[model samples]
Target: MKQWWIIICMILSPCLKADNLFIEAESFDKKGGWVLDNQSMGQMGSPYLLAHGMGVPVENASTLLQVREAGEYRVWVRTRDWVKQWDKPGSPGRFEVLLNGKALRTTFGTEKAVWHWQDGGTVLLKVGENSLELHDLTGFEGRCDAVFLTSSLDLLPPDGGNELADFRRKMSGLPAEPEEAGEYDLVVVGGGMAGCCAALSAARLGCKVALIQNRPVLGGNNSSEVRVGLSGLIASQPYPNLGNLLDEFGVVGHWNDWEAKQDPSSARSKQIREILQRHPEKKIHNAGPATNYEDEKKQSLLQGQENLSLFLNMQVYDLRKEGDRITFVIGKSIISGKEYIFRGRLFADCTGDGEVGFLAGADYRVGRESKDETGEPRAPLKADRLVMGTSVQWYAEDAPDRSGFPDCPWAIRFTEETCVPATRGDWDWEAGLDRDQITEIEYIRDHALRAVYGNWAFLKNQSSKKEQFAGKKLAWVAYIGGKRESRRLLGDIVLREQDLLENISYEDATFTTTWGVDLHYPKPIAGMDEEPFLSYCDVQEIKPYAVPYRCLYSRNVGNLFMAGRNISVTHVALGTVRVMRTGGMMGEVVGMAASLCKKFDTYPRGIYEMYLPALQTLMRQGVGKPGFPDADKLD
Candidate 1:
């Protein structure tokens, strides 16, 4: 019995050691530890150097040292420069290194381009490793990977010293800040499909552009965070280019690869191809779930060849103008509590909420306009009567061996007396979730998704349907609501249902939207007592509608441009034009117009009278067909 007790004590001794091993890497930067020395770089504030590298790096090119724990450690790295000299043609690049407050006498060689830390040379680190950092002044360079060490067993080599050094050089001399006094040539607000194109267009045309985006991710609703598939028409007989350049950036392979396996006649495949052909250099921006834009400098197109910069995490607090010509925009960062003063020659209010135009003394309206306002029979007799309420759509994932029957908040409401007999919720009034009021949509969607999870769990553990969903898992919950419609900024041209149904085309038309006036019922019970949910539409056949250039610019503000569902449209008509594909087209047109504004040094309105030809040419190159010089198409 005593021997058995000794054996048990011996087994537990390893679990109860004197001290467990841990490691921690440190540096002075935005991260707490070692701060960088940028006095030689003319930095007024303590700006820590951010790293850059060519090719996709495992961590951020900005990430120098990744520490897992705290303990005595040995850290070693090999680096190289791009300079191929007579002495060593491919030697390690020039690099700066600091280990434990001591600079190492390490000259980089190019021969070790593929080197990892364990290959002969490694850095030594002490317990509670205080500081270890390398500055790659450049943004992103070629072959810069790092390996940190707390123990000899955990050592690995570093690669691409010259590439890292090049990154450092680029980071050393920062671009001069925008002239604090003068107004910018063009100011684009929003970073969705449209806003991104608009800023790129204006910048390409040599206009100083300041793109203001509120969302952390640039692609807006189509982003992974938003989790919606990209929608647009491809350039062919029926499809025109919709502003889908950003979506193309995130595409891994051809859409046909997936579509061919599912449906060969899928038109969505062709549309995706057209978008990819136009913008091949699309870059993906993943903001994760519920990400907040921290620094505009880090995320925006701040490094434009001309003077286009993005300000993220910054909210446009107010708008100030001089009579008709807009003057300045005041914004503040929610994180830093810093203020930004943007003075632009022309302003574009691309805020989906039309916040900029609404604040800039521009006239706007919410809901449907009456027949008197826009002589359309479909228009409600009462002006501003019925607006498209916002929708909150959500999705649920099935679990593996699904046995988690979580309870739904609205489960009590789902009594057999109230609901129709159905297994899963669908687009019907029967067992489908109910969302009557705009204010209640969020609550309804939340509860609906919750109910889905709960139902799955009940089937797995409690319900008789356990055999069906034995192994299912609930994947995720959408934190942000899929907001449908909001305030529309009054533009130079008010689009009506007639423009869509009629064969009318302006010489300065930018893109065409083909979706019909599709509207949903107010509530499940409002229009349906004996039936389920129903969608109504006046037009049965699908026909393309022309969206003119005038619709993109504000009626009142000089520089303000508009896009997405907030563009000028009658309530009934907005039902059609507010589709995501139409939004992409609007964005592309906005981008092209912004470029034209920069090229011709003209206001957005001026493009209608002056640079119409240039705008047409841009469309021809981008979307495959310019809307102008073909008035017969309208006939």
Candidate 2:
């Protein structure tokens, strides 16, 4: 009877044959310029790869696959023709797939708008390691999600939605629930300068912290990836030690010296040139110090902390909430496709987009508020959709000889009158303020790229000063767009512009914002052709004002804390507090609050209401490096 039962089980079991191979494009071993874009996951089904060709075809992305069986297998790729949604003609993004050393006949990035599997003819594979490469044919932003290889020729890949997610999980052999990562006192999402400071401060205060970042590097906007300089004041009156962490991690000198009141041909230019010559490897065209060593220094500091566990290239997508508190967060490794379940007593939403708070049903606001709502003079009369735009900064280097640039007819056209004849695309080159900053990030980024390519082409080919630019070659253009504003999580006290203008002081004041009410709007240039990408700044300077602790934690979410640009503030007030230095101070204050939470075994509201004195004590003591010189101050 036992022998008969064993034979029957063997006959009925479905795991007798070999499984097919599935490779997620974002998990490729070598992903050159192609970036992992997960912003549109809700609409696209899953995170995918974006070539982000800023007018030039980026490098190819390749991955190695170890075949289990030597046999013929059919190939299918999940992709979409992105521009097709606009009802536009011609596919801007076109690319081919290479197997081993040969190219597949089927070209990708030319399909319909909706994501679906495009069939690539069957190919023979040997029982060994095979090379798969995404060869980009155009410098025009090709994209892919995953590649599916199956022995059965008739097997169709899942279309999309939850089914596609399930298919990916099954093929990748991932469990339904993510593997237990570990318990932590605080889990801080986003590895921007603010998040970094928060994690470091919490760890210093004896809390086991998990710092999860979507990108490979720390310092979101200030990192080499985005290259925006830190602004606003640090180590101001109320809290002298608040920005010690910022000073330890920030670049020493000012970046926009040419834009200052001083003349461009001053001795400062010569001094800067000499400094650049000393470090030729760091030659960044108009941008000073392409890579900041301070980021590396901060990463080292975080790693040295025994209580803080840093997880790079991990994007937190979902959270498990028990009532108002977040029990755990689910993050997927961008390179390995492995899910990590980060359990924690408290969570910090330092993500500039306020994504974690949005996921947890925290009250938030986006775009501008009306005069009736905010009661600020700067507020719009009838709050229309207008938010601060993102910047895609670029620069060019003067070659020894003449350099030729290809005419990008696919890009938005720019005439001589509409072109910006500058070598560097600085802070003023901003766009996408009218659209959804978070949901339409890819579009915003691509539009900025189009503006850059179009303007450059005009300068090289049609402008009267073409002779002057003939020897210049485009050196660098940031594919990772530096966003300015997004969803601001609502807190107990929504800091208003009146608070700063009137110099109202709160008893729970932690940090001071020194920047002016700097807002951005489209510049009115003569003979403008398309949507103006370049923005003009409108500044309303005010004295440095203290930001209160009540604006650091979510009002509704029990254990939620926030920092960075997403902290509770009116649009007018955000104009002053959104800068990196001020945001870093906010992170410092939240870190102190987190420590108090751990000490008292309470939530964020509890710290604000019942244990305010304890938090104030920590603020007075400060959590930064002891005896650090107060070099950074508000003028």
Q: State which candidate has the highest lDDT.
A: 2
How many backbone clashes are present in model 2? 1
TM-score of each: 0.57, 0.89
For each of the candidates, give the backbone clash count. 78, 1
TM-score: which candidate is best?
A: 2
- Scanning candidate 2 in windows of ten residues, the lowest lDDT window is 8-17
Query: How well is each residue in 168-276 modelled by candidate 2, as lDDT tens digits?
Result: 7767666667887899999999999889889988989999999999887888887777777777766567776678677656333322333222334644345434544
Please give, for residues 226-293, the per-residue lDDT of candidate 1 as tens digits.
44443434342222444434333334221223322333365555543454455332212121122221
Each model's lDDT comes to: 0.48, 0.80
Per-candidate alpha-carbon RMSD to the true structure: 19.0, 5.7
Residue 423, candidate 1: Cα error in Å is: 10
